[model samples]
Target chain A: MEISDTELMLLGLVAEMPRHGYELEQVIVHRAMREWTAIGFSSIYFLLGKLQKRGLIRAYTSRASNRTKAQIPGADSQISDQESEPNTKPRKVFTVSKKGMRILKNQALRSLREISAHYSSLTRGLLQWPFLSREEALAALQDRLEALRSEEDRLSGLQLDQQPLPDYENAMYDFALSQIESEYEWVKRTAEYMETKPWN
Target chain B: MEISDTELMLLGLVAEMPRHGYELEQVIVHRAMREWTAIGFSSIYFLLGKLQKRGLIRAYTSRASNRTKAQIPGADSQISDQESEPNTKPRKVFTVSKKGMRILKNQALRSLREISAHYSSLTRGLLQWPFLSREEALAALQDRLEALRSEEDRLSGLQLDQQPLPDYENAMYDFALSQIESEYEWVKRTAEYMETKPWN
Candidate 1:
């Protein structure tokens, strides 16, 4: 089961406790604010529904509220007689199932392992002494420049029928292309600097 | 438009020329293998439909091939009548619109700017000297360790519960928590090392 980041966070929350939808939403919004995990209330309901359908979670109604309602004569009288029928306004309590927990654990392990490996690789690459020949460095830089050129050309001819695009969408695309162009420029400057260096 | 990486690649391909769904899928899979933008054939059709709905692309049908029913004269007459209704299989031809081009440009520029900013920030941070005092560092490390201990306690109790959890999901949470613990240990060690080092 390929779960999104939001689903992963949802599973973590449920593992903490069997919480109602509203309560879960509050925990995600207020408690996990620093973690940068922002989930809308509607999305919590949506994910809960999806998780239930997948059998990763099970929902049941708590009896404490029912006991409170029973104290009022009208509340007891108005209660539906059908036990099998789901209550329309009942607060649903959710708990993660065995399957859900297994998935969560595996995903967590994989992510951690991946992060460790990436950090190790980055450290090794950054700290390694100069090993590549000048020819090799020049070749790599040239290849990167060629790739950038192709991307630039592809972006340049993107206009259709000579008409300007709408304001917002156009701005976004232009911004991205400009960023790519700027990176290309940086690469070019770096290559020039390398050429002038005594080591080269 | 905030298109995903896959969507951007698909749009770029379609922007080049009008092609049928199958052709577009083939182009992405075989020719652009090194680009690491592979998408399923169904995803191609789905994206095409979405693009059409969004008015980013328009589809047109190609002309049908000519064929005869049989060499028989009566069969030919029947075929001609059928041809009047146009026995043409619709081949969807996609073309990028002005809106799509604008969106592509904006996305490209934004990606460039964001990447540049990120690299610059990373370089700046790594090159800068540590500003935190020894006391502050020690306090932060202690707080982090305490938080990790609390988390470990919570996880330990969860392990004693009767209900089993999915391995992957549990592992994911465990790994994330473990990373926090590891970072806390690293910080403590680094602070100790800093204290023991002689001043220049």
Candidate 2:
């Protein structure tokens, strides 16, 4: 039940106040500094759907704008009619549940811990690189690869049974998997190359 | 002119021996550990196209097995099969051009520098966080936000006019942008919250 960055943002928004999908989209664009932030319109809906499915958010139907179409003579009917009419679909309002609040707190704490761990691990790895032999480097890479592969397997298994995620969430997961796989491959190739060549 | 990680690998493979698209793909998969490396099929073609366009790679019709049709059943079945399927769609045979090789060397150096810079920057940012007063933190966050926005503008402008990029290269650019934007938004919100809270 690990929340992604998108989920974290969605929850944080809801925690501030109850909001529907469009409103949430507007808030994210206006308040989140759109010059830097680039959440697409579809991504907002995707995140809102995920939050609701996870039971972190509750959605309720709200009255939305409805405009009647009027027939106009000598006009491109299809284009003009569609433009004049307003969307009539019921808007879904979302509020953060108690479970959502707990998840947010847990995620924040986890992020702080991860940031510290990443910093220390990166520092140690850099410092040790010059002193280590090729074999040691290979071994270190293998250990990291194994851990990443395990995480990939875990996420893959989830994909098989879990409901299809929204495009953005799926994209995020794919990106993470690709990054881990890329690193693992690079390490393996370097190791093989090093083994064959005369060690400098 | 810029070589991404996947492009670099492709260049390395070509440096070893001249290869066509299918052969290069296989080499990437088997010899280079591409599955672990996270290089996708689309990325191979994309890089090949770019390299050829840049005159860094050459194409030749080889008597290679074109299994593409066999892989896809009868989408265009009217045409009779021939005994020798000359890879007429220009099976790209890549060789490391002098310019390409020079670029690759520079890229390796740049990558190493970037890794060190990233580690130092992350460390500096995190350490500085604990030392800053509320006002200072808010100012710092604003500066970062502005910088990120400028970066996003550059990326978007680059994307709009440039030729299509390989999947891995595109992914790297996108992932970097997303990471910075998320952090920028988070810092801005956190700064606002801190401004309201009473410091003990």
Candidate 2, residue B69: how far the Cα is off, in Å: 35
Task: Score chain B of candidate 2 by TM-score.
Answer: 0.43
Name the best candidate (by TM-score). Answer: 1
Model 2: per-residue lDDT, tens digit, B1-200? 56666676676667667777778777655432341234688778888788767876666654344555534565553342343245434454667777766665555434322321112122223222332345544555466556657757865666444447543334334444454455456555555665676641
Q: List runs of model 2 lying over 4 Å from the truth.
A: A33-38, A64-89, A116-200, B1-5, B12-94, B97-200
Candidate 1 per-residue C-alpha lDDT over A1-200 given as tens digits, one digit per residue, 9 for 90 to 100 = 85654676677678767988888878755442212233566788899888888887889987555545455565444544333234345778999998887666544433322211101111111111133345544455566566667756754555332236432223323433554555456556656765676651
Per-prediction DockQ comes to 0.02, 0.02
| Docking verdict class for candidate 2 | incorrect
- List of clashing residue pairs for candidate 2: A182-B37
- Model 1 lDDT at residue A142: 60
lDDT of 2: 0.54
Reference-based lDDT, residue A79, model 1:
48
Model 1 interface RMSD over true interface Cα atoms: 17.2
TM-score of 1: 0.40
